[model samples]
Target: MDKKIKVGIVSYRNTRPLIYGLQHTALSNDIELIEDIPARLADKLKTGEIDLGLVPVAVIPQLGEYHIIGDYCIGTEGEVASVCLFSEVPLNEITRVYLDYQSRSSVALLQWLMRESWGIFPEIIQAEDESYREEIKGTTAGLVIGDRALEQRLISTYIYDLGAEWRAITGLPFVFAAWVSTKSLPASFVQRFNEANAAGIPRIDEIVAANPFPVYDLRKYYTLNLSYQLDERKRKGLELFLSYLKKDNEQPVEA
Candidate 1:
């Protein structure tokens, strides 16, 4: 490697564990970490601003070539509290939906669920920014993701967990984001990267202490709600979701 690897990391609480490992270990010396929302991070990766990114799986189809260069991912087996649809009324009753601009995977998953599980086609609006959060009212609901979604848990009357919905529909774990690169990285670098990530998985207390989120139980959120391993089941879940994205509007298919 001629230069330090520039890695795009998501600026969300869910990614703190991985960040902890990078900052605490020698990996920090080898890479430059640029933190931002998932959507922007994907953009950086696309524009060659970064060598690798913890980008949304939804961005996979858009990339001409990609290397999912990790043994870890931001995944969940069931009920991921952070990625949700917030509504005052029942999901089916809502006539309009706002997709979070900061997200890619959550919005895509919600769209898939609307077509398949819910069997309703609400007006989908892509939110421009944080100002759109205030528009979540009446028949106009919104899909919120990451830390903001966690904060929203306090105010939202009706919350629909996308992870839980996907589980009920497909009976598999869902992966939101993974470490990906357009170029093939050396095996030696990949090894250290995995080790660095693994080192942070056990440091829950350290992570929370470093970056406190008093709005929710950060510890439980890290330990249970988010799964880091990109195992066989999660791989299948990722593939299944991507398959749905590849198809068009056809009144949904049976899972």
Candidate 2:
């Protein structure tokens, strides 16, 4: 018997299509899958707990030796509803911003936006409590991501879609997450992995239909808002993001 390839995946709705039908595929026998939020997955990959993961691109700089194996990614051309900052006041008026602890990518992206795009440097605090409607006085903003952000968008008077914000500033598509590995994977296995993900893209509606969740327009989120492929433009976006991370003097942690 061959050793199973341990894979870590994010449980966010945006990631639904990417792993669609993976369990039913022939690769399932060789793949041991574990699902968690993006940050945890990245940690697992860093600690050598998981062989491969759908890691946030921001954390790529932190992973000492890694390989990005697949063509598909969690990305957006414009306006990504899931990764957003819900602010009570205008951008410049914000004095303090709450950071989501789930994903480092969103946090890093928000930091880049504040420093480079908006030209405002606010005190960033972590949101220990996932409070959507809790008030924190004047000029307070909350950085929310994943399904919670989807719900928070409704009540948020000032919503900043980070992906769209990045595009508006850089004119490039955003690649939020990608399949990364600490060690080299077999070419055949990597090819099959990409094929499995590609095969799921067109079946977005079906995937949504099977897993119904209230208060979300899954079809619009999947088809209109986000993209699944990691094309040239998105690669440029990822590169630009890495450059920003470099400017911050962030280094990849040796795994």
Per-residue lDDT tens digits for candidate 1, residues 129-193, read 89888999898899999999999999889999999999998999999999999989999999999
Taking the tens digit of each residue's C-alpha lDDT, what string does model 2 give over 1-255?
269999999988888888885676787788898999888898999999999899998889888898998888889999999998888788889988888878789999998888878999888788766563375347888888889888887777898899899999899999999999999999999988888888778888798998787878999999978998899999999999999898788556679
Over 4 Å off, model 1: 249-255
Specify the poorest-scoring 10-residue window by lDDT in model 2.
128-137
Q: Which one wins on lDDT?
A: 1
Q: Candidate 1, 72: how far from true, in Å?
A: 0.6
lDDT of 1: 0.91
Deviation (Å) of 238 in candidate 1: 0.7
